[model samples]
Target: MGDVRAPVAGLPPVAALVLAAGGGRRLGGRPKALLAYRGRPLLEHAVAVVRGGGCAPVHVVLGAERERVAATAELAGCAVVANPDWASGLGSSLRAGLASLPPGCSAALVALVDTPGVTPAAVARLLAAHRAGAALAAACYGGGRGHPVLIGARYFGEAAAGARGDTGARALLAARAGELVLVECGDVAAPDDVDTPQDWARWSGQPGQPGWPGSLGQSG
Candidate 1:
């Protein structure tokens, strides 16, 4: 909620809001944000993706291991918003993230930490859609929709109010289906979630493969 990094001029400035607060109950109580990926925390990777995709002054919503993540991850330029009620679900994180954005932002490109498979290209697609003037938009994988939904400044309040529990922004997206822009990202990305042990095993690298850190102790 503090002052955000001043955005560059001319180009439309979009703030990247990363929802990394989930407790990862299904993943054996591990904070999904702290989960290791390619020698860094999953939360860090999510932040990088958003930045690479052209979002300015990224904001990350942290819940589980809020302190540990701060001590460990390299969040130099990001604004970290800790949600004490993170146990409530993605809804709380979503609301907290939206509220934390500073004034003068043009839009919010919401991303999730658990989604490593979501590429920067997918995020760029959402940014493109937003530039085209879509009030609401989301990345669509194959026949279904997925993460990193774009909420323009006009609908920030309504979207935050409607995001409830584990549903996140699903309810809002459904209600605005007629106006929502679905950018197909299946060809360039996979919307697989690291919500289970098996899911982690696949994305976190195999034994000896360059993936998650060998020891979790380095996390803080």
Candidate 2:
């Protein structure tokens, strides 16, 4: 297995694809990127996570209220791409993000903004797990696999082709399971996401309510 390890060194630059383009159909049309969290926009946190996870030249996909998000959110140092077809599904955003990588980028660490439970530690583990130059790696919580998937440059075309609808690289991961590397991150982070109103309430700091301060998976 080529001594699978964390914190791959002397490797080509790894760019981050932070998929923040969701229209938030489940949240009554509110854009997930603009959602309030930790005194800043959710997209800001996602970008910080990507940068903190040891990736460079982070690319963010914006949709729905793209203009508002661009204007209000602190997206400095990130390459923002607007996905007009964002409503089509997560696949389109994934494709757009992948296509926007800077020249010479060898791999893309894909992450979702909705998954507030994911932390930079999980990302570091997945980055460390990349075996060959162009290998597949993903994070796992307990027994189930979760987001922030790693797609080597060699598989970018195939991964982008399979990226349709809400299934972002899952089809590829399922078919290439034999070649995939699963990094167990259950101890360092949570893989759950803030998808529903109940989740929002749980994270919301209300009187007499046990709020999840930094519970959306902040770096410890």
Candidate 3:
């Protein structure tokens, strides 16, 4: 695979909130974000996609494997924020990452650490739609919505404040359905997340699949 370089267009100054606080119970206590596929931690691949998509000031929320997560973030050259309330669920981590965003960010690109397949192109597409005035834009594949959803500044407060327990921005998106824009992507990678060992195995076999790491079996 090519070097994980920033995009030539240079990502906008939007902040990215990478949710990496989940305890990988399904994977036998293995931190899902730290799981390797194609020779790189899932979190590292996820961060590379965000960086390649032209988003800046990326912040990763660490919880279950805080040290490992923080180390990955440091290696990626992105900021790391601890989500002490991670046991409460994804919403809390989302809130923590959002709160850590630097001042003046007009929008945020949110991605899950376990979702390493979400592509930089899909993320850039979401950013384009958001910049084009969509209140919320998500990447869709095979008729299924997926990660790296872009939320404009208009709903930042609502997303950050309305989230509770494990209830995330889904509620906000449902409440503002009329303002949502779904961008169709031919790549199934956007919708594929490594939740179990089975998922990792299946995705590993499909390295050519869109949204997945280009170097499926290469060590980073």
Ranking by TM-score: 1, 2, 3
Q: Write the per-residue lDDT of candidate 2 for residues 93-162, one digit (tens) a residue.
A: 9999999998877789999988877788777777767644337888888878887799988889989999
Q: List the residue pairs that clash in candidate 1.
A: none
Q: Whole-model Cα lDDT per candidate? A: 0.81, 0.79, 0.73
User: What is the model-wide C-alpha lDDT for candidate 3?
Assistant: 0.73
Q: What TM-score does model 2 achieve against the real structure?
A: 0.87
Q: Rank the candidates by lDDT, best first.
A: 1, 2, 3
Model 2: clashing residue pairs? 116-216
Write down the TM-score for model 3. 0.84
Alpha-carbon RMSD of each model: 5.1, 5.5, 5.3
TM-scores, all models, native as reference: 0.89, 0.87, 0.84
- The true-versus-predicted C-alpha distance at residue 88 of model 1, in Å, is 0.7
Better of 1 and 2 by lDDT: 1
Cα lDDT tens digits for candidate 3, 1-220: 2223353344346778888888877665767667665676777777887887777878888899688656653345688888888889889998898888887777888998777667777777777786677768878887666666888877888998878887777877778778889888655355777766566657665433433332223343
Q: Largest lDDT belongs to which candidate? A: 1
Q: After superposing candidate 2 on the true structure, give the runs of residues whose Cα lies further than 4 Å from its correct spot.
A: 1-10, 131-134, 206-220
Alpha-carbon error at 41 in model 2, in Å? 0.4
